[model samples]
Target: MAMSKQQRAAVVAILVAGLLGGAAILFTGKGGGSGEAGHEHGEHAEQGEHVDHDDHDHGHAHDKPAATPASAAAAAAAPAQAADQPHVIKLTPEQVQQAGIGIATAGSAPLRGSVDFPGEIRFNDDRTAHVVPRVAGVAQAVPANLGEQVARGQVLAVIASTALAEQRSELLAAQRREALARATYAREKTLWQEKISAEQDYQQARTALEEAQIAVQNARQKLVAIGAAESAGKDGKDGKGGSLNQFALRAPFDGIIVEKHLSLGEAVKEDASVFTISDLSSVWAEFVVSARDLDQVRVGETVRIRSTASESQAEGKVSYVGALLGEQTRTAKARVTLANPGMAWRPGLFVTVSVLGAATQVPVTVAADAVQQVDGSSAVFVAVPGGFAVQPVKTGRSGGKLVEITEGLQAGARYAAANSFILKSELGKASAGHEH
Candidate 1:
């Protein structure tokens, strides 16, 4: 179908006019000469509006968002919403792994509430002793050194005492007298039976023998009371008087010699505490509790103890709780007995004691590391369709490892358990970009 010349001419003119109009619109939009400034101002105004819109969107996203398709679409459409919405984060599985992020499922956990108190590790007083020589003496041989471990009845030092020598001499003399009196009494009895000795003679001899026996017993008891009888040998004799003045200071129990005050040839008093021995297998963690906290701490309650110097922890039982408060501090003394395996919990080490209270059953709980601070609120990075989402949470009681989520999260929700801080860092970067 061929057209006439006039019809073709009219079609060409209409095409030329449409092309020119489109070029004019494009030039005006690109800020052509006269309209350039107005165009730039309009762009700046649009950017300001975008910033304002984002700020408003972020405010609502941090609170609770309804679980609906519209909200989901809104969350997906806005990349900046990842920083604004508490329920959205933009990360692929590969990116999440590259960031060293870990996931944990929220679930029910037994929440053991606890109270903490500052404490100090100390020697168990029951197993600690200050060794003293009952008799004043000169230290002859100092065998035990400081920090040396000794068993019960082990000799710590040997002392030479004039007083001990005299006591032993008296015992020896009494024994000899008792033997002689026994022989004389027997001879007198025989003579009287034969009518060769008088009855009075036999009675005097018997009385003398009884007195001698009493003297011997008295001397023996004196030595026993002074801790000298054990070192006196089997026959109750001190090496036939050669070691009459020698007194051995022995350990009262299995312990380590923590203090040594006496040296060889040093003179010591009878009541002087020359050595301090303590058992390090177990130690006491002593703390003070206020009057209001007295009821919370009780004997036989299990407590968690942590060392201040290191990442060391142990479980202990409350051994003692004072009935009276301190006169000056107005606080009651409490103690926990902890087993010091390998003697790691040394005395004088500072510790924190956590007294566990009743257990609670929480419906939703996550690892403590999963909860991170986002926008100044407690939040968790929850896994969503394409990436992880920031879920604002209301937290309740928390143990060291797990924390209870009171709201804003549900059971079976996967979250970043370890290295969640990485996500926080990334979120901060994204927010900073938008801010600029």
Candidate 2:
């Protein structure tokens, strides 16, 4: 089938157009980072461009892209706009999970004032005493042992002394003298009534009776003072039932026997110590306060004491805060008086003292979980209309689980208490995209 030249040229042109159109469609589909697909499609475009075609499909299709340059440029700038736009964190249905953010309204409670110090138990000096004999004696029988409880007037020991023997002799002689004085006084009265003796003789007899009675009275008083009972007189109990001059060391006050220095049958001097008694009804807790914390302390303020060695807490009032600080330790001494029940707060015991001070109140407080770090600053995630945002905040004093928010949030604001870190990471990724 022979044809003319114009018909053959027209057939070739149609064939070239169809091939160019197919190659342009392939380039549009492969402009992405897909290496092999783009490489092959670019090769197909180069080959089609060289092809001579009066009717070219790529010529028509490629012209459409140039028509919308402003639109494409604007579309390319969309990612940049997102980067410049303030971050709006989108939460998944699960991520939108609400966290229980604890918030508190500030109120006042008794600010239990407290102070801490290191202390040890000590005996009250004023209430402690040592039993000593007033006169030199030989220790006879020590009836009470060491650590024995004795009452006032309870005999601790009996001492036999040469001084005691002399005192007894004087007492007996004085008793005879008193009896003689009474008889003499009666004789003087009779003599005066009978007028047998002269007035001067009768007056001398009366003066002698009075002097003798005074001497007897002085001797009896001395015996009674040396721990003896007087006047077994008048009841026919006039005989010396007990040794009048035997020194009985008695307790001066109601207390516990802490030390016993004298043994039975041992010779004791006037200065020798027989027993030491401590009144345990009240005890002292000696505490050491640091120099920095000294000003917070005051007398009569209550404090709490506890020991690491045992599970006991004792309450006491500060009896004194030492005027002078320790030169070596640089600590002031605080004396606390605690009621020792059953002698539980023993002397030489180590304890910890807590002195509570005034408390400061704040108007607003939030949970520690609500606070998050953003851009190297402390912030919190606050729920907004569309999404959540990181808000910077200023904080003050902190307590357990709660912290005082001085600024950056108000009452009734919802904040994310948990899972805020996830949002932070997401924001970082969005920033990374714009960088690319």
Candidate 3:
């Protein structure tokens, strides 16, 4: 079987062409970041998430990429894009919805401007009282304790005062003398009518009776000035009664005992503040305003108060504003009175005061939660064809619920509003895969 030279050359060329085609297929199946990323993402997502490959299906196969012109081009461009911009988060409409991320459109909104100031909760001075003993005494029994609620006219403590006893004794003596003088005056008048006594003698008895009555009235008036009841306690000396020195201190109004300076067996001065009671049904939120910002605050205006230590917040009206500024701080103090049910607004708690001003419309605004930090710059996840693209943005003034975007985001652009951290976590994973 002899073969010709031309036929042998043709067989060698066919073998060379087949070998080259196989090598090209092998290379195409092995390399492509996009397909590798998509496969890895789909596999990792299966444990906790469900990703749809519907119309947004990836061009690359799971294990081996199809190596189509579109998939290859995407694979080649992924690294360069990741280096310059945030990675495009690959997600279908169903998957994005299933992820529990609320999508909202950015547009104009009427936002009220606010001025913030630090503040503190304080006792309403109008409802607070510093109780004084009024008379020097030894505290015998102090029933009121610190942080105790008290009712109006409730006995707070008992005081034993020698000075009080002496005054009571004087009143008792004056009463006895006045009784004797009245008897004499009655007898003298009868005798004078009967002509059994001289007119001058009857007149002298009448004058003496009037002088005794005046002495009794003066002594009684003296005891009344020091808050002592003439009928209180025992007047025992030869009369079967209790000690007159015992003085009961009673609360002037219904309140809580916030301060206590007297203890059992303690000697208190006449002017000492033995107790401090305050009606805690209301509290004052106090803040300082700079001289330049005083015009923003006014009496009868409403304000918002937020606790710095917790999530408690409240609304109140500005009740007072100082007419003069502080000499050292150069600021005027202001206060807002608020109803405090359940005692939520406790005194001494630090707070944030927000004074709301007139509203203004903004061009492009979104929910406050939509803005995220990527690479130390603020950015928003914007909706693209198949997924969200990271958009760097510049932020302006912010209301509590909405924020104004000055650059990089257009009106009517849809963005993640709530639960956006899920997208942020996925973005971080995609970036790490590229680095590896």
Candidate 4:
């Protein structure tokens, strides 16, 4: 099993000659066939998939050539270059298409970026009203129910109050006094003109008439203040009996009643919020913006409002932006006025508001899905000989479906725009194999 010194010297000489030959090939690789040099290069590597398999298996020194200084340098440089090289996923163009990976050419596009904010659907305050009974009374009849729609002048409820009866009686008495004074003043003026009475008596009667007229006017005005009519029913005669104390409460405008606190025969206060009515034709999409992004959102800008509860989407303009932020939230409140013609945007519904910005054209861009995370870097799978190469890219502005690439890719370069995660998955598998 052991060789003599003469045989050992011959084997060493053969190894030394092989080393020199391999080094010449490595040094002149540019001029030689690359396929042959690649195989020869494999023979020189010390570790990782390039071990000298033939010599180790045969237990013979001559099975592989010796490695020289030039070959050593070249072999060491191969892996280092590979470490920095773009990962290549070997797949034919047909395979890429068959796998449902969408290919897109990176190019110029108009990018309209948007800032998103969480929001909620709210009642349009201008169209919302908290209905209150302006006069204290007992609710005799409540016709309007919660969530019922009512028109302007529609009777919402009927109330009975003894105060109303007293006020009406005062008005009637004032009118009677005014009428009596008017008759007396006329009689005194005629008597004065004919010298049948003293001028002082006529003047006194005129003053009494003026005071009575003022009292009648004051009583009528007091009834108007409480939303009561000066007279009851069409006959113009005051109500039969209890009708004088009855007050009919009417809706101020056409809207749906959202809340109701009054019930039949319930005693109510003068300032009780008996009902809440809101017009559903329009609503507010309220949102809060951070201080840093306050400059981006402004009045008159358009925004797309979407709801999470359903597939409801609508467009509206920024109607209001608060000048100050909340002390606890540190966020400025903003609202968009959305026309809810179908009443789809209900109050308390969650929504997302995407405030649109002005559009600008950029030189290089790709579909948003084309970009992926590659070793903490943004990269795209670019078209290569077999399939695609992981091309590192610096992303700039992003809009609807495209992202601006400021670097690492050029215009007209095709790349995987969809299902590119397949390529990333392949790269992961390759990495795991190498580690193992």
Each candidate's TM vs. the true structure? 0.71, 0.53, 0.66, 0.62
Writing each residue's lDDT as its tens digit, candidate 1 over 1-436 gives 9999999999999999999999999887776655778888889897988877876978766466557998878877787654455345688889988988888899998999899999999999988999999999999888899999999988888888888888888999999999999999999999999999999999999999999999999988988887885334422223344377888888999999999999999999999999999999989999999999998999999899989999888998999999999999999999998888799999999999999988988899999888998868999988888878788999988776899999999999998899988888877777677767
Q: Is candidate 2 or candidate 3 better by lDDT?
A: 3
Residue 119 local lDDT, model 1: 98
Itemize residue pairs with steric clashes in candidate 1: 86-390
Candidate 2 weakest ten by summed lDDT = 231-240
How big is the positional error of residue 308 in model 1, measured in Å on the Cα after superposition?
Answer: 2.3
Tell me the tens digit of each residue's lDDT in model 3 across 1-436: 8779998999999999999999988888877766898899788778433334532365444556447899889988987876754468889989988998899999999887788999999999999999987889998888889999999978788888888888888888888988898898889889999999888878888898888889888888877776666854532222244478877777888999999999999999989999999999998999999999999999987788999999888888889999998999999999999899789899999999988877899999999888999879998988788888888999987787799999999999999898777888889988888777
lDDT of 3 at 190: 91
Q: Which ten residues in a row have the lowest lDDT in candidate 3?
A: 232-241
lDDT by residue (tens digit), candidate 2, 7-106: 9999999999999999998987676547877788889778875653523645665445455788889988997777544455655445475532332333
Which candidate leads the pack in TM-score? Answer: 1
The number of clashing residue pairs in model 3 is 1
lDDT of 3 at 279: 90
**Clashes in model 4: which pairs?**
none
In model 3, the clashing pairs are 234-242
List candidate 3 segments past 4 Å from native.
Answer: 1-76, 81-103, 170-230, 233-242, 381-390, 421-436
TM-score of 2: 0.53
Off by over 4 Å in 2: 1-108, 193-199, 224-245, 288-297, 321-334, 355-436
Q: What is the C-alpha lDDT of each candidate?
A: 0.88, 0.73, 0.85, 0.87
